[model samples]
Target: MKETGQFEVYVEVLRAVIIAVIFLFLLWSDRKNDLKSWDGWRYILNGFFFLTFATTIDITDNYPSLSKFYIIGPTVLEAILEKIVGYLLGSILLALGFFKFVPLIADYRREAEARRKAEEFSKNILSSVDEGFIIIDENYRILSANRAFLESAGVEFTEAVGKKCYAVSHHSEKPCYESGEECAVMHTFQTGKPHNVLHKHISSDGSPYYVEIKSYPFSRENGRVKSVIEVLNDVTEKRQLEEQLAHSQKLEAVGQLAGGIAHDFNNIVTAIMGYAKLIKKKNASIEEAKKYAEQILLVAEKANSLTKSLLIFSRKGTLEVMPISVNDIILGMSELFRVVVGRKIELETDLLDEDIMIMADKGQIEQILLNLISNAKDAMPKGGKIKIKTAFAKLGETFIKVHNLEPAERYALITVSDEGEGMDDETKARIFEPFFTTKPVGKGTGLGLSMVYGIVKQHKGYIKVESKKGIGSKFYIYFPETNEMPIGMDDSTDKFFSGNGEKILLAEDDNHIRRLMENCLTDYGYKVVVASNGNEAVKVFCENDDIELAVIDYIMPEKDGLEASKEIKKINPNVKILFLSGFSDNNIEREINDEIKNAELLTKPILPERLLNKVREILSKEKELTSLDSDKLH
Candidate 1:
């Protein structure tokens, strides 16, 4: 293959050129998708080395022939290969460096977007919260304040940013930490923990505010305290509500105690009054003795009134419901009211034109009026005018808003007004609470208005109070109105009639009660037979077949009043039955059927006069029954 040196050199040069071109093509042939980072760059570098090695071998094998032409011809192939190798190496190194570090650039972009979103969320939370917030640096300088905090402090947020906390708030000459009285922010920074404190702050209007502050330490990376974040809350209204709840609970407990004692005392007073009346009647000829008995009775009656007042305060008294004209009740109490109010305080009355009937217990209603009148008189101790007015009232929407009730159909409006020093809003709010009195101890029990409130509520009524500090007070009692008339004895006439010889059967559980009834009826000229139990009374009546009246204790043992009444009616349907018991009217009426309820009811500890009147009335009516019975017998 060796020929002339120059020819050989020329062949080598051509071969080197071919090798260099092939290597360049190989690098260009590696496409964008085929470029596998550093590994693909390494393959391109190895191809350049192989081309250089082939060019060196061609130049070495034809050295003498290439030197004959020129010194450059001999190494020309080597020099070209060397240049190609150097350029390929530099390109491979640049590609490998870019591929290795490009991932860090993508990560930096992702982190920048996340940080932007977090900052936006933080800004939204700070702007919208109702409560105030403040952040302070470790040196006790304000770092930031929210809109709420700035508004509450009466300053612009920008103006407060770099000011010391105490300078802007308390107007202190130095920082709160330097003054050293346990500032919440300073404490949080010092301990690197949270500090909670309740404090008073004066608002822009000079009104005091109760605020709760929670401060937590904001720490740096090296565990050093940097700042404090504080959250503020206004608790003024909440504190007032708690105080009101406590006052209400105190009144309730006192009412319960007072009511329990009153209930028990009522029974004792009833017994005392009954025995005293008996004494007075029996000792009529002994004038001094009779007078003493009557005096005792009077004292006991007064005590009964007091007990009734206590029961009303406790809301424990049972109401004896009856239908009565409001006009009549007012008329009945007017004279008594005038006497109590006396000459110093002027008394005024306004009665409705039309008769207004209401279903209520008469004694309770009377007591309610009397208490209000007494309170009015006391309010006007220096002798002012007192007015009592009654009318038909229908509640309106405006009334409902003030009184917290739905508008009602009709009401019996009773307004009691006095020209005396009135109450404030605070006093008015608590006036109806039991045992809450402005008067000194022993002067008032503070139960007057509370009792009024309880009774009115129990009757499905509402009351409103209006008063000013210097002007007088007016109390409006709105009692529900009814059209039904009251059915009961009229005690206006004191006349007692001797009975017309009608036979009667009296059934009583208590021996004393039985004796009292028998004596009262026997004195009135009626043939009276006494039975201890309902069973005995029923058996005796069935055996005799001549009983005209059957009076049975509704709650008695050994055949109750209702059962005995049914049996007696079976024997003689014409027999009149009267139920007597101390139990509640509801308990008796609830268990009894409608057919048996037609029997007249008499609650026990029966008044002697009431007993006599009922007996006389029954016998007078039985005269019509006797003829009917005679017809049936024939």
Candidate 2:
């Protein structure tokens, strides 16, 4: 019995010792660790101490004296006392500590999960964006950057953040603006508004490229900008494309001009060459020589006209402003256009009664008309009427707003209408685009309307087109009216001047110039008897006895004007004579002054109105003298 009791006490002491050692170790660890601030851990520490105390009491109870120390009359009260003071109390304290601690642990887990989700969302957004995005603080330090920004900067994210932007991107020691470079971030910070600009950047291959930067201010407080968000888009390819297109357009324009010149000059050269060969023939007679010479002169006139036309081919880059009447240009081209439209098409004009004038480049205006007319002709491969009209207009507020024009009140509107195969909506929309055309490939430059558009805009004007497929198209061009007039201009300058029905002999040595003169006179209602040279003038003069006047050129092939006029005078002393000279050749001017009695010499390059007015003045004076002599005889 005694040995069994001692063995039981030894087992109890061992168990108590193990429990107490665990409690002391736990307390020592908690005190040394960072977990000392944890109230839950502190609660557990108090519970452990109680457990250890209860275990000690159990160990002591193993002794017979301690076991019955609380017993009374063998009622077994010692067991109850043990339960109340040790095991029961210790179990309650442990339960209470666990109950207070579990919720704190759960809260810590939820917070960690939320932070992980937020970081993931931010990383996804940074990776998905295409443009380089960077957040910069006021100190020029890079706070954060997306994947694109890091790649464009040629730096890793780990190497980029917390570094100066200039140091990382530009490899400069100081800020970008300090080196006289434009900084979008600086602009955003200074203005507290969005900033956009084009910047030159270096690529990874060490080549230069362009980038467009759009930066916006963010985190603003108290009217102060705290940070900026920069967005960078590389525009190198787009810029190169634009430059190439402009170059191509220029080349196309030059090609078109060259083609036109080659066609016209070829005809002029052929005629001149052929006539010169004929004149060089060994068996050619004086008359044949004169005839061929006249033909050569005519070719020369055509060349001169072509040269004058070339003067109008100024580039849109410059302007030569002049006050010109559109009606006059229309009227002057009327005879030529009849042949130009190919006999099938009818040309009609409805000009404003006032002979409206507009401020414009004369050559560009001519080009506009020619292009419209040619397009009209092409539209009607079968047959159609092309009508041109000019009217004065007052652009209202609505029109000014729609066209985005300068605040101008009056404008001249020109409309070219064609009854031909019209264009659909898609065609109309793209007609003015450079290199856009409906013509067959290799047939046209397709730059006509596009150039026309550019010229109108260059002059601060506007153009509009209305069309329907299979119906027709009308191009409306508006030019702002200017009050300023060029010097030496008349309200009625007769670029299309005409004459009375007077019978006259027209003589010239230059065939083309003579032809030009004849065309003008015949169109003006004059009875023109044409002569190629001085001898021809004299012969034609005698053939028409009733020819009222003799118009002569001083320089000619066989017989000169001074000699011819002498012969004509012998035929009829009362005959009137007018001499047209390109210039006063000293010898001819001297001879003409000495020999001719009441003849008037007019200079070359004379305006049509000047020529007609001079001829009329001479003829009117002759009639006045005839009337006076007849009155005296009566």
User: Each candidate's lDDT (Cα)?
Assistant: 0.75, 0.78
lDDT of 2 at 105: 69
Question: Native-vs-model 2 lDDT?
Answer: 0.78
RMSD of 1: 20.4
TM-scores for all predictions: 0.47, 0.51
lDDT of 1: 0.75
TM-score of 2: 0.51
Candidate 2 residue-wise lDDT at 72: 63
lDDT of 2 by residue, 1-634 (tens): 7787668667767856866775686568556755533656656666676666666554333456334333364323554464456666567667756865787768878989999999999789877887888889999888889999898788999899999988987899988789887889999999998988888887768998998988899688888999888888899999999999989978876686677567879999999899888888999999999999888878876675445434322331344468777788788877877777999999999999886667776767777788899999999999999999998888888888788764567788899999999999889999987668888755676767877887777667899999989999999998887667655755655455455788899998888778877877787878899999888898898899888888898777899888899999899888888888755455665777788778888766554576777777888898899999999999
Steric clash pairs (candidate 1): 5-65
**C-alpha lDDT of residue 590 in model 1:** 62
Model 1 clash tally? 1
Residue lDDT tens for model 1, 144-198: 9887788777789888999887787667888655765557887787788899888
